[model samples]
Target chain A: MNSAASEPALIGLDWGTSSFRASLIGADGGVLDRLAAPEGIMHVEGGLFEAAFTRLLAPWAGHSDLPVLASGMITSRNGWVETPYVGLPAGGKELARAIATHQTTDGRTVHFITGLASETDGAPDVMRGEETQIVGAVAMDTSDGCFVMPGTHSKWVEVSEGRITRFATYMTGDVFAALRDHTILKALMQDAPFHDEGFRLGVASGLSAGSELLHRLFHVRSMPLFDKIPAGASADYLSGMLIGAEIAGGSAGKANRGPVTIIGRDDLADRYETALGIAGLTTRRAEPDIVARGHFTIAKAAGVIA
Target chain B: MNSAASEPALIGLDWGTSSFRASLIGADGGVLDRLAAPEGIMHVEGGLFEAAFTRLLAPWAGHSDLPVLASGMITSRNGWVETPYVGLPAGGKELARAIATHQTTDGRTVHFITGLASETDGAPDVMRGEETQIVGAVAMDTSDGCFVMPGTHSKWVEVSEGRITRFATYMTGDVFAALRDHTILKALMQDAPFHDEGFRLGVASGLSAGSELLHRLFHVRSMPLFDKIPAGASADYLSGMLIGAEIAGGSAGKANRGPVTIIGRDDLADRYETALGIAGLTTRRAEPDIVARGHFTIAKAAGVIA
Candidate 1:
């Protein structure tokens, strides 16, 4: 250890299935530089994880001894090392304890953040790295409300008093893939441009006639067997059917049932807001740099940086 | 025309997808003879439907011209003709009126059975020839309750006062096939005799941890990858997951949603009953011959036979 401790630098990283992201930050919380690579956990063997990560950070090799925090699949069972899920309503300290630290050849310390767990409507949702983003969003806004994070397994999170109160995961993207690829509805579609009409129809379908949605999903295939419906629009119709159901199911939850504050890229957030708005909920947009904000908030709370 | 208008013979036929059954009855309501053949709707091309049916019933040839009643998929949009679905809480009469009839080579009149439809828990369910079976089940037990007919698409129907009040369709069989054929779960299974312990464990997993069901589903691939769970039991586990959900979803309508009366072949019905029983539902066995019995009931009611 040096006498001045070399003024320890800080780092934040978001490591997902197919991609990796990292940022080098000064003690003042400003990004000095960043790096990214196609080194998501999925493509590499477990033993090669640490080496792959280190090579990606080699450009900023001077700060190799810096304190680094990582999130996402890096903590999954197949990840570098399993960082046990700390569970929902979990905050900075709990997640901090779950982090796995490793050393690069040059001596930098790496801390992999833990995922989160929460039970909603009797179902449990476990998210590996998004909790950090959620904390950042709340810290930036300091607002007690709902946060919608859209992805393959979309999550709607409720937060109050600076802690994640509850969350639910919907298999929206996976369901879309299954229906489009596996069902007869595939015959009725062409790769057409996206239209607000298609998405709007889906949102309404999900809310008003929500219960009959799944049953009608079967008819998507049956109707075209006869001359009742044209095949070209079946894919579009199926999309509406699923999206509608998801919007309705998400809103059915009990906590922070008030309004929603969506934190995501502009387009996704807009789409979510459009759907939720139709379902009669008020909405607001949070900054797009949610993961970074969450990292900053947690760092401050944990006394890692002022 | 003969001066006496010789009493027309009455013919009852069950024209299903894979096979055909014909019963010739005298005006006295006694079966004079029965014939079975492989010439079902599934074997013939669309335009060749009539020729196939006439060829199969050749043994009943030379019998006086008759009013022939048929049931099953032969009347679907893909079959002989489309018989419009009559919404349920319906009886044999409603189905009869919807049948599309045609004249055969020997001046025999053919009356095809229409399907039935109903709404439950805000979802619409439809059945083709199976409507006849429900009528038969009700005739066998007029006291009335819930009757479950298991097959490719299993149905749990509520019958009251000789009418099918409402019903729901569960994709239990189709899901089983998809999992067994298309998923990672397929890798774990073998053709040897199934272990009921594996089956029971799946059911227990679904019931007790029903809410976390989807999360567990995603990890099906991960568990084997990490060696946390065996690959061999994955198929059995998947079967249990789907069937378990079916048991829960199917029994939601009965009183305390009491035991369901399963009407099908002994083996398949027994499996369903056992699974549902494990999920805490009462189950009873009904005859698999419900379709044939309902055919006779309709013939008697039509005055085609005494």
Candidate 2:
């Protein structure tokens, strides 16, 4: 690594409910070094967030003057600094405007990036950390397109003119996990490598018109009972079905504007890519470290980085 | 009770996964006596189903000759005696014809009533015990209609000419329980009595056209987050949303032939009734002890009771 490029300009943190990750960013917005721990806000004991943050950043102790930008659940009500959500159409500027800051015990200021809330007419939708990624995506590809972010709570975001316009959240991953591990469907599912055929079948079924998820989920049990899908592949089948249903709801009423940009881990992104293809939609993967890019963007918009 | 109606004619058992109920039926199809215990098929230790059955039915020792007809998960693979499923269009006669008999250790004959399977041109749906209730409903009305049986796994049965033509299973209750108790939506939820307003809002949202269960389920979290709904009532809101989604899927493509006959406990039936009303469909409750009536119907068809 070049010595100049290794110079830390900003400290970026992606802290969620169960995992924490921090990245040291160069002036040119490249991640110079990174650290990860199971020190999510939820796991931080006795509210010792200051000490935990200090310990996690011990490797970069000398860079105390570097601006720190934190995102994800670390900015929630239960997190280190509670930041109000920035309502749509919000971009990095709006998020930076709403950033809540906390002065650490060590005289360091940590700027907690606010999340985004949808302005939809029906039930409201909110996100904690995904808005930063959305901003990063917009910065990378200044196009108006939809972003499918798959995770425990998958978010379908629509970005237009460098700002989030409207979005919806699908409990696809969490619901899949809950159903797979807690319901009768678990009895038929066995852990195995990802099964492509089973997933394709599930995606087709999930994307089928008038397909109801609650009803189709029962098929996870019946499909195995009838030997339509192997028991070991039922988990993948269920995952596909859920992701397909998410796509169905997520993509409804929107004209085929463009290929949806998928921003998620490789495994989940792969599943969504396959399912979206089955749904007759094209998809492209977002670059890795979008969260770090997102933090950089928000911090720059906040004038913390030059 | 009338002395004649008090005489036991058949022993009807609704042995399910988590609960067991046995009813003594009179020749006139009236329930003469009833016994229930926590001794579901799953709770029977060391596969000692025979011993558990004997202990639970010690009250009817003198009526050992009474033909025992068992339904529900007790006939499933995990239960005492596994019986194959009877395909649609199946009624009491078909169920009786497919009944598998198991000779108890005390020389008593216990007939296991097979469940019903849909012959639809897609993924097959099966139910172990709801078919009996559907048969009982047909026996009572003798009219073709849809039966919405709400429980852990809600079944929507289509009956025509006194037989189950087709049916679909929705994991509404099971999914609700799983999400409520196991997912993040549980965080904002406080266990409270059912809230009508929250439930109505959820039902209306759930019944909305283009409503997707996976997407709307996220509202359970966001609704509370935004204080659009009280945290305590979120559970009921989630329930309504799920039930409404179930109604949406369960009623799709079916012409409004008549009011859906709801065969379930009073509380769930009430919720379904309210949700179906919101969906602009009428509903009527099936009489109590449809299981006993079902047993009587199957026993009569099998010539075990005359």
Candidate 3:
């Protein structure tokens, strides 16, 4: 195992509901190679996760004793193992202690990272993959700050002293997508693009509509019919409102005096960054592979690969 | 024409997307008889609104010279004719001034009531059927107050001195239905009933999340999994949140020294009433046929029926 130190550093597996990607990282924390499959945990046929896992990684069976780290929905009750969520205030080193492991029939060891559960006073919240991203985030900046990860389920996380102190999730994307197709505004904007001007206006509207999203959404209908909102701007307006409302809603009570960190693919992160700017809040974009880095960082500190 | 007035006070027709209801009113503005059909403007095939209206009313061809007053989507671009919207601060008197007339083949003139347009400082807002309801509400009580009409597209209207001064639309029911059937929350709430306790909890969450509805919605997913929110309560909780958030967002920026008038069917109005109570606001329920009253009141004031 120690002899593989010069070989590929580690395998980072981000397995979610609809897809899974495996990143081969070098000892220098650089991604050397990667593989992704359409086999998300939801569509993992017949519950043959191990068989699927091995078949997916069959190409690298003989690549030394490289330890595999897994994250995302694959660790849930429906996935391979129901890894109990590690409660709030945990980072890479702390998360390392509660890692779940399994030995493959093909003579290899795989380590699955558990998700994080919040200790918030309102509701019990949890996240599986973002914890890794946040860890990957903390790996770069250990100082205290709030982090925004935009996606289907966008997470607003707070990190202080190397641990994920608290967080919240906003279903911004899903709600916007569904509403676009499901509501009346969908008809007028079926072919509308995300116009920059319209989007900015929507952000402003969303701030005004904050939490009153139901009432606010209809503006997409009235504004257009009123010609106040031009043609092809309804969709952008919807997007802006959702994102703006999300920022207002996600950061409502928090004492966010400083800038927040946003982590996601370039496109999604860019949209959030734009809206954050409109809301007069500053933001820094986290590296795209922050999750992979977190996997590498946390696994290393856990002594799983060393 | 005046002789026919004795036969029937007026015919108040509520024509909308999915259904059309024709109400026969007496000289006293009381509903004498009613007829409903599935031929809403949307389902009316072949654009034969005139033919359909004739065929549907053939059952009472010679009953009276009742000036049929049509409202709702039937006057939109897709309906028989696009009766232009009457601008805001319009009650029955102002609306009457903008009435459009259509001549039927039988030499009868149908009086089409135009929808109301808001002169609000922001975008142009319009409503067809709700305006009639508001007019009717005004007929009953000519005072300053906010009105909540809960439905697929809920209307938050303000009336002063018999005129619909301002109004806003909340797609609360539509959003909830779509989120239930189109989003991830739908998966968790396949059979979620409106649990009373869950509804209360959801209402509170909604008020908290109203400013951040997108952020707060995700709690439906995590709280259930964390065992903090019981199974099957997610849907109800979501309902409460949407309703509660609507109140907060809708009521924001408004000065309400008086109670609101909530109009709708029993179930939705009841839920809204309960939520309004929880939100520390007072609500008075309007009759189910309030729309008819509005139409009749406006038509009488305008001398459409005498």
Give the per-residue lDDT of model 2 (tens digit) for A1-306.
322635679999989999989888888777888889998998999978999999999988988789999999888888888877887789988888888888987799999998877746477888988888888777766777899999998999988888888888888888988999999887877878889999988887787634377888889888988998888879888888888788888888664688999998898888998888888888888978788888989899999888
Q: B1-306, model 1: which lDDT tens digit per residue? A: 111333435777878777788766555434566789887776886558778877787887776366788888787767887777788668866665566677766576787778876554333456777778787776666647788777756777887778777776665565466546654345556664555765676676555533343334444444444444466656666677666666665565454745678887676676777788887777777754556557767767665455
Candidate 3's C-alpha runs over 4 A off are A1-6, A253-256, B1-7, B119-121, B253-256
| Whole-model lDDT values for every prediction | 0.66, 0.85, 0.82
- Give the per-residue lDDT digits (tens) of candidate 3, residues B71-171: 88999988888988887688888878888888988787888888877744366667887888888877866666899888888889988877777888889
- Fnat score for model 2: 0.77
* TM-score of candidate 1 chain B vs. the reference: 0.84
| DockQ, Cα level, model 1 | 0.14
- List the candidate numbers ranked by DockQ, top first: 3, 2, 1
* Shift of residue B87 alpha carbon in model 2, Å: 1.2
